[model samples]
Target: MRVLVVDDERGLTGALRRGLTAEGFAVDVAHDGDTGLDLATDRDYDAIVLDVMLPRRNGYDVVTALRAAGVTTPVLMLSAKDGEHDVADGLDVGADDYLTKPFSFVVLVARIRALLRRPPQVRPAVLAAGDLVLDPAARTVTRAGVPVDLTTRELALLEYLMRHADRVVGKVELRDHVWDGPGEDGNVVEVYVGYLRRKLGRDAVVTVRGAGYRVAG
Candidate 1:
């Protein structure tokens, strides 16, 4: 899963990025509300950690803008204020969840997991192609009811392919989604595809002549 942490506090955001990555989640950090809002609006993140106080744009404004733009990606609002009005306002402005400052990382992760439990309106929980099954919650892949252990990058690549099953996913698409934010080696996609084909088997995923890859459904 991918998460965006939007906070001006470099220390807090950095800690979140490290901690969430360690927990098997791809993370992106935004130091300000504008950058954060842009990422949240443009990308398909599993969840967002947005601080209520921000420069140029507050959390409420950011959430309102996202909702107005029809970005229903779940958001967890963070604030130092525990006042009843603040909490209510955050919820009223479209935050899916709220966390007061001095919060425990454990609790924050728990809230994120809970929000993720609710099905995404755009992305489904389980993605499958032919006999292959991927459970996002379990982070497990199975073929013909047999388990397949995948490396972190492999799992991420497979998940991306599954999401666009049967479509010709170009190298650019793969790079943007599977790898971080592009600008890496173009051959990285091909290399990772080769790795996935070796482990998941060639028949499980196919390559087009000029296009990129597809998982035959």
Candidate 2:
């Protein structure tokens, strides 16, 4: 899964990025709300860990703008204010979830898992093709009862293809969904597809030559 961490504290932001990355998530960081808003506006992310007290623009304004612009990716608002009204304000501004500072990483991970389970109104969780199965919530994949291991990026790409199984998923779309940023400038999609093919089997994912790729039964 990919996540954007928006916090003004450089130390905290770096810590969150490293910690989350270690926990099997592709993470991008933005130190201030302006940069955060820009990245959030420009990219496609599974979720956003937003801090309410921010420079340039506050978390409330940033999230409110996102909702206004119809960016429905889930946002988990982080704030030092643990007051009832503060929580209410965060929700009122359209944060999908909220966590206070001095919080446990375990709780944060749990909240992120919960958000991934119910990904806004966009991508759904479970996807399947024939006997092939992927459970996004569990981060698990199986083919005909045989479990398989996939790297974070591999799993993300495979999930994308599986969600659109039998249909062509172009390189740009794959990059947008899986990489969550611009200009990958490498054969990452192809390489990860190769990895998936190796783990899932040679006949699993099919490249559409001059088009894109597809996952088929």
Candidate 3:
């Protein structure tokens, strides 16, 4: 996969370029957000590792512009800010993933791999199923025109399901996309589906007996 590393830190960029190249990726480096934005706009990249603070345009603005321009390539943002709101803001701006500074390079590779695994397609900014609406960029969900609050895990699960609402997703598929937990137990899928059902009404998510779960699109 081809990846872009956009950060002002030269040493970090160099290290990432070498490390990611060693891991079998064609890595490109951009020291500021303007150069990053230009390269991102012109080239095709499988994933991007963007830093929050940059010289020209900030990472948030770059990602926002990319999404506005209909760029659906997955982006993994890098930042020193580890606060909850900061993370939420990154995702709200269309980042596919976020990692705090001084993070493990191993984890970074894992995250990039995860991003590459995602299906590349243009999806609506807001996903809808019946009266339920999910704004991925805003990280908000509403049911029947009313705001519905959900825990982070619940929201992630629902987002994945809603994104694939056209079909019945299996237990293993849900676990792979939703849970970052230790085990791949299919039971976790059932528990979270139950949680979603409770919050979104019993019939909100349909159970496919011996298959999996399906949500209306």
Candidate 4:
């Protein structure tokens, strides 16, 4: 999972970066709302952690702009204002979920997991392909009921491929979405696919001859 945290509080953002990273999420931090809005607008993120009180643009305006621009990624707005209307204002502007100041990290993670599973009728929280299972919330992967430990990058790559299971995902697509962009190395995707294959099994991810890669649904 990828999360963008927009907050002016340096200490809080620092702690969030470390904690969320430990949970198998690729996290980016922006100290102010303008930067946050830019990152959210430009990148494809699984979720966003936005702060209401900000330096340039407040969280409300940022979310409003994002919705107007048609970026429908889930947002969990953070605020020190715990009043009834304050919470309403955050949701009213288009935030998927809201969290007040001094909130528990566990609850925040749970709320994010819940948000990811939105609409309930579609998009299962836990992803599976045959006997391979990936629990995004727990950041764990298992094959045939046996546990597997994957590096953060490997997990992200596997999740993206599995999310679009059975479809050919091009190298450029994986580079943009998984690596965030092109890197100096041209074969990064191939290298990581090799990493996943060693752990998951040789047949887990299939390569399309003229296209890219696919994970069986």
Candidate closest to the true structure, highest lDDT? 4
Worst 10 residues of 3 by lDDT: 176-185
Root mean square deviation (Cα) for candidate 2: 2.3
Model 2 ranges off by over 4 Å: 180-185
Clash-forming residue pairs, model 1:
none
Tens-digit per-residue lDDT, 147-172, candidate 4:
99999889988988887785799988
Off by over 4 Å in 1: 22-26, 42-46, 82-85, 103-120
| lDDT per residue (tens digit) for residues 96-202 in model 3 | 99999999998998887667556565556678999999875566889999988887667777877787898998877676546523365658889988998899889
**Model 4 off-target regions past 4 Å?**
119-122, 145-152, 175-188, 209-211
Candidate 3 off by > 4 Å: 121-217
Ranked by TM-score, top first: 2, 4, 1, 3
On TM-score, the candidate that comes out on top is: 2
For 1-217, candidate 2 gives per-residue lDDT tens digits of: 5789999899988888878876666689998889999998998787899999999999999999999999998999999999999999999989999899899997998898778767564556677888889987778999998999887778878877886785898887787667744667557788888898889988898888999999976
Residues 1-217 of candidate 1: C-alpha lDDT, one tens digit per residue:
6789999999999899888766656688898899999999988887899999998899999999999999998999999999999999999999999999999998998888677667454556688898999886677999988999888778878887887784788887777655555667879878888888788788887889898889877
With a 3 Å backbone cut-off (N, CA, C), the pairs that clash in candidate 4 are none
Give the whole-model CA lDDT for all candidates, comma-separated: 0.85, 0.85, 0.82, 0.86
TM-score (all chains, Cα) for each model: 0.83, 0.87, 0.56, 0.84
